[model samples]
Target chain A: MRSDRQNRTPMGLKIAAAAGLAFLHLPLLLIFVYAFTTEDKSYQFPPPGLTLKWFAVTWNRPDVWDALTLSVKVASISTVVALVLGTLCAAAISQTRFFGREAISLLVILPIALPGIITGISLRSAFNLAEIPFSFWTIVLGHATFCVVVVYNNAVARFRRMSGSLIEASMDLGADGFQTFRHVILPNIGTALLAGGMLAFALSFDEVIVTTFTAGQQATLPIWMLEELVRPRQRPVTNVVAMVVVLVTFLPILAAYYLTRDGDQISGQGK
Target chain B: MPHAVTFQQVSRHFGAVRAVDAVDLEIAPGEFFAMLGPSGSGKTTCLRLIAGFEQPTSGHIEIFGETAEGVPPYRRHVNTVFQDYALFPHLNVADNVAYGLMIKGVGRAERAREAEAALEMVKLPGYGGRKPGQLSGGQRQRVALARALVNKPKVLLLDEPLGALDLKLREQMQEELKALQRALGITFVFVTHDQGEALSMADRVAVFNEGRIMQTGTPHEIYRRPQTRFVADFVGSSNVLSPDLTARLGGPRQWASLRPEDIRLDTDGHHRGRVIAASFLGSATRITLEIDGETLSVLLPSGSAVPEPGEEVAFSWSPGDLHVMGDEA
Candidate 1:
């Protein structure tokens, strides 16, 4: 009876699952389809025609290049910051017992749990009070607030799953604190940090809500794409840029998924 | 000569629970010693104290006559084979074995040679390149053993290292470990809850219960003369005769104990019983008898004519077999 329950899914549940997946991905599919549509200014039930012209148009645009470069730079910097801070936070949270440790962990994850607009507005206000003018660094900082949460989530889960005996054994086998960290702890946590960093890079790459608040004049690719949507530029070109952003963001997330999927089978410390 | 390891009035308390309390122990150099106990019995905690992984709450621990207080595990001249092996999964067999040599700043080439020698010592000569995940339970145990031994420390600590292996493999490893300890001529302090393992391998055994040492003696002495009820029951099975029986048959002692093997059935001897139950073991038949309304177990050799349940029989034991116990019994 238990096995039968697992094997047979109700039709309603199957339909709901499919509907949920379509709700998420169908819009992204439409963006991909419209990227090659010949219609430059409007949408149609089916593309009246198709062309390779948008690819050329997007390639030649210097604004696109600048925005893409800026987004890449911000994501890269934010991911680096997230990796360092996130792993340290995870190590501290999991490996130690102190008062308010749970509270600190909750605080670490609060930024991501809050709506992006709230984080963006708060960062903007903090930057304003400090008299700090918005720049590339401000955009990077805005994205890093959430990026750290992503990295920390991945890292702390892995940290909790890891066996503490590995560290103790290293010390017992004659490794000092530094040696144990270097040889034992680091290797154990390395792949989790990598996956977390890649995920952070993806999250920062396509982020628009926070960028709009922190980025004053400089436009990241997503911000520039938002501008193109408002103005009467080549509509297909906007879709083409959207395609680039999707691929850029999607690949890392896919890689991160695979990294974490295989991560469950850690280097086996037990028989 | 100074003892290899000594603990004087050691106590370790966590919050309100005494994980290890007022324990005093001494191990001679090159001794194959076993700390035997059930889980949460403080055997592992005592081993940890000697390795400097844990500190005494209010007493002294010495290793090779040097105070172990406040000393780090890495600084202490000791190494451990953790119960789960704890071989670094990222490293292959050789690299795991060479971890200590690398930490000591030995040159890479020299470390490699020693690691190879260590692997050979553990009888896994060609397995240097295989990851720990590729090895079986017994092989991983050997790797962990070699990893600790490579440092040539004065003392080696094993925390239930064979707990994961199957019965046959556990027995094999027990023999191999005993032989290895003899070959190395280094003090080995091993923790295990298996009474048979302690009896078959250790030169001396310390029985722990409830964060306290119950007794320490050679396996023969411990089994033949358990001082406390815990030792009698934990180290090996024993039957504690009732107070009435002790007063009648225990001569002058306040309490009396007898091993099951010591109790014999003669069918013609003085004491009489009706066999209440019988189990056919491979080498011996376990016979449970009701004698004078109290239960007594006897082991009769297999292939002999065993009395059926409800059959009346006679049993007897020599005066020397009635081992006495303290009030703690």
Candidate 2:
């Protein structure tokens, strides 16, 4: 009976699925093609020629190196901050009952739900009010605001899905609170945290608008790419950087997807 | 020796609802005790209290002569096999059984050796390398048992441990658990809603209802002489005779209980009733009869003449079979 249903997928649905895949992935393919293009001036179809010169050019640019380093630093720090804060917040909200718990959960996820421009403006004003200098820390702080939400969303879901009996069993088996967390709770939520951290890193890596308001004199990779687009200093170099960004960000998101895809099958669940 | 667990007027309340109300209980050391009740009858709550997962709202609890009210579950000398067999999914069976030893900083080699031996005792030897998810429900149950027993807790709390298995497997585990408890001489406090399981397994059984114990006694005593109407009905679904019916049955004018197996269908009996339903239960046929607007259930042994529903039948029990019960609601 299941095989009969599998064999009868409508042609229109198949076409629609193919179109959706093409629409999402074709631009990424274009970015890869242009990264190798000899045309450094503008977008050209089937470029007059493809060359490896752009790769060397991108590699030699010290400005590109600086921006790449700053972006990596901001993303790495923001992801770490998000991982700690998000997991803690998720554990608190999912495992306990208190007044305003629902409201607190909503507020924790509010930064990501709001527009990036709104978060950026509010953060900029807050930083100004506090008279804090906009250095590398400002960008890290800004990225962490939304990065935390991404992580919390992933973690809270996993925490809620986890059976509370596991914790009880741990304690009953002679584990203290910390020991139970280390042996039982940590193992159950470990993959979820890893996936959330990966997504947070990928989100912070390509963040543009929040970084724009928070960054005073810093040019993160995205801000650098935006500047190069407006002022025209080696277009293919920008495309090469974009290709690298895609690859770098794509790997983690892919990893995160794989990590959480079979998460429902955690052992001893529904038993 | 001190009692394995003692609750002196222990009560746990959640806002307006009383989950475990003013209940006193005593479980002896090395005794197989069962707390049997319907859901929400405080059996599981009392078990949790002994495990130190919950603190009483009032009154004191002691375990082995030690005050247990403020103590944490980790410090308590008891372990539980949860209904779902809460095994750690990430670890293999061996590591799971070794989790407590590891927490206590046992050497890895000894932990492995003991976990293997524990598995062997549970009849799951060499099943250690597999994850809990790979095993069937029965295998997971045994691993949970091994995991808890490996700790050698002074008191072992099993909360509906066999509730998740099939009927045949439940019976098998019940025997295995009883045998294991006997061999180890550990106090086994089992919580179950199954009367048969409690009856067949435990040395003493406490029947609970509405957050209070209706009665506590040996299975034979509880079955043969249930003191309250609730106990009589809950334990075996015996016919609870009203005061008027009790008076008519040659007993005092009080509530009484008559076991279904005690009544026999006799052609010359004085009592006559119309059969309402007849169910064939393998070795016996249970016939429900309406005698003077009062319902009476009678069990007939196999090969006896089976009466059709709506037919008039005569049934009678020995004068001693109708046991008078207390007037408590």
Candidate 3:
């Protein structure tokens, strides 16, 4: 029957899907395997033997500590900045009827849409023209451009989906403007903002290209990892650091996915 | 006494479209008033204006003797039960009901106690912990009621509050709403397009059409003597007789209306017509008759001798039953 055909997966298609998943995830599996490798100088196919010595070495290295701390600091600051800017932009764009509103929305998301090199070039030139020194703040500025887009996309979708009557009901029930927003509007979009903030943190943690232009001499974790890859040294340590990077960036994205999964639906609402 | 709410020459326009035209009206304190009209009739807009969600584009509004011009909804002493309930999705029933008090900075323990009492008021005492989504449509409606009533405002504006329920639930809610209004003694200004709801629930009904009130009166007065042709046809089903039919009924008027129940089918009667259709309603049967090429509806109670289609029937009515319209001095 047609139902039977739909219920069963063909052998060829099942194999193809398995192959695709393996192709995407196999590199991460190799990274984990090499992090425990006994060989310190070369990447032998089977990783020769396994040990935990590189983790101790990574913990003691001051350069790795500096890079890790800087990456965390930049990502956190950028996420905070993005949450405030993106939410305000989303509220203005979604809640009002004004001329050139679409243009404003397009402008908010343009930095993310443009190629990273183009964004880097523009930021570098703008900073140069303004005579601003590149430092931690400049690095944060570079990360926040795309971070704001992620937050804006999530926040605007939620703001647009939320029923306007909820705010009206709050007002009619004797809640002032600030109170209405805190009690009604904030609760409605809280999960969305959290998800957007998490995703932005993940993106900023792994960002490399924009940081390359904006950061003068400061080496973030990704930049340090790139340098380590170019000039090979204690190769197993680099693999161990990659494992940390994967975990650091992957946890927030995973949490963000779960947060936004059920956020699109309004409880007790028809649509 | 000053009215609970008053609109003086109010009008709200969205660009070229007049959502609420120049209007004047007053709602007395503790009165159950209904705005009855079809969609886009500006009844909802008028309710929103009272709620201060929308201000009059051109007139003045007053609440409790004070001119409420430019007053925000939060500053006004009025609450609303929206058609969709508009329950806060993030909070449980207790928190949702307590939102107004929380915004007003009421103590947590006191707010919780008041919320429970308010829930009990609407007959949903133990549903405080459940999410609004987990409850049924009727239960959610009660939660919305509890949320608005927790504040105890001077007037409660309901924008088609029972529109989302089934027929049986809607009927039950209508009775409960009327009882609640009487018990609380608060002004209840509800809007709806269902004439049955307006007639059975509200003390006074204002019929609206094309952004203007066609007539406003008590249910009996509006039903018995609808002033405008729109009020006659929209409020209830009526056989709007032409000027010719009006004259034949011994009425001096340009337009007249006759309720379907007023027409009687008897063997000995003044007028004769052919039965075109017979619809058997549970309590009453609506029989359509064609007299002189003009169709009329005659409603007869059940257990009467029913007329078959294509059968000839004689109908009669008292001259006083003819509601002559368009005879203003």
Candidate 4:
């Protein structure tokens, strides 16, 4: 009888969730519809005509490709750096007793918790103080600072849930330090690491505020879209590019969700 | 056989608490030794110290006659079956059991063969393809044992290996573990808080309290002749009476320990008492009697007629069954 009530609750929740999802996608659907409108100068409620010209125009633009490549490069490099540093920090903090561990953990998470504009301003000022020129590397560094928090949060939670006895058992079975980590700890946390890396990559790909401060003359995809919005002739192309960005970033987020879904249940029971 | 593992005055302190006080013990090769104690009594800590997970604050530990100081768990010729099993979740049964063999760089065919044999020994043949999550609690435990035993170490440490199983399964596994230990002829050092687990499985049991070993002996000896009050009370149900009650019968000790089964109920010429409570436990009826304001519990055979609560009764036992213990020692 109690389980019947539990079943009804999720059914109600599913309907509410479907409504919420429709609200979110309605605006996105309008954007896609307007991308094909022949009346391209202004974003009106209903299109006067429909044509494939905007996609053709978006495809021919070399500038869009340059921006897309730059965004990819920055996101890839930043995600790699975040994965390595974040994993090391998580591993060090998760399994040991030490002074200032809480403080260290807070510091690792603070970049993402703070406002994006604040992070951008601070990075800009710090770069100025160091007398470093703004370039691709500076943009990469800016993205990595915030991306590390995503990976670190996921990896640390994974590490904490992992049973310490597993490591002890591995060691007791005559596996050396590196071997134990390879055979036991790594396998246990593998799904979490993949999920974290994917989330970091998605976050870095779409980030615009910090990228604006860090990239002086170079334009990433988001920054390029901002430039195109301000400029007069490239309006429909901007909508097309925006749709592409959503797809590229959304796929990884979806993949990350699926990867991490089973991890929580497995770790909970394994403990 | 010579001592396979020994702890000489070993102690470990965590902040202000002494988790394992100065303790000395020797485990013979192929012997099934159990460290029995309540939670926080340092039985697990002793197992950890032997497994090289924790360094002693003082004293020395030796494995196979070699000093174990500074030796990490990986270097020690010992393996452990942790209470939660700790089977690798990502790996299937075969790979989990073969982990140790793979670490030693054994050939794939040999490792597979040995892992299968170990699985069969645990009565889980052809379960090699299933992950730990797919198996039941008991199956996971068997996989953990197979993983540990596949390494063929000199000593096997089990820290409450049956602790997570249900009572019936725990009893079944206890016998299987004992038989496996005999067949393998590996020294087994089992740690548990359950007296029945220790009494049924161990060749020798070491009773621990407050980070110190109170007594160590065979199960019969420990049960029949407990040297300390703590051991007598912890290992089995016992009737504790003030020394004044037994002074006329014997010594000057302040307390005397009597096993519940030792007390005989008779109709006359015995210590007269009133029945306070009677609990029928299927095999035996445990009767509590009030004598001179003190309650003494006695376990009588199921067929014995028990008096109603508040009825007069007489309790008597053989003089040899009384174990005198120093006050709270």
Q: For this target, which candidate reaches the highest TM-score against the unseen true structure?
A: 2
DockQ of candidate 4 is 0.76
What CAPRI class is candidate 3?
Answer: medium
| Candidate 3 per-residue C-alpha lDDT over A159-245 given as tens digits, one digit per residue, 9 for 90 to 100 | 988887888888887888888888788888888888888888888998889999999999999999999886666888888889999
Error of 2 at B109 (Å): 1.5
Candidate 3 has a TM-score of: 0.92
CA shift at A149, candidate 2, in angstroms?
A: 2.1
Model 2 chain A scores worst on lDDT over the 10 consecutive residues at: A262-271
Every model's DockQ: 0.71, 0.75, 0.75, 0.76
What's model 2's overall lDDT?
0.90
What is the Å distance of residue A235 in model 2 from its true position?
A: 2.7
- Model 2 interface Cα RMSD in Å: 0.8
Best by the lDDT measure: 2
Model 1 Cα lDDT, one tens digit per residue, A1-271: 3787799999999999999999999998999889999888777759999899999999999999999999999999999999889888988999889999999999998888888899999999999999999999999999999888888888898888778788888988778888888888888878888778888888899889999999999999988988898876588889989988888877877777777786443110110
C-alpha lDDT values of all predictions: 0.88, 0.90, 0.89, 0.88
Model 2's CAPRI class is medium
Model 4: residues >4 Å from true position, as ranges?
A1-23, A37-60, A263-271, B248-250
lDDT of 4 by residue, B197-271 (tens): 999999999999999999999999889888887888898967666777656435565677889999888876367
Candidate 1 lDDT over residue span B1-329, tens digit each: 89999999999998899999999999999999999999999999999998888888899988989999999998999999998888888999999999999998999999999999989998999899999999998999999999999999999999998899999998888989989999999999999999999999999999999999999999999999988877887776787776666665535546667888887788677788799999988999999988778888888887778999999998888878988785547
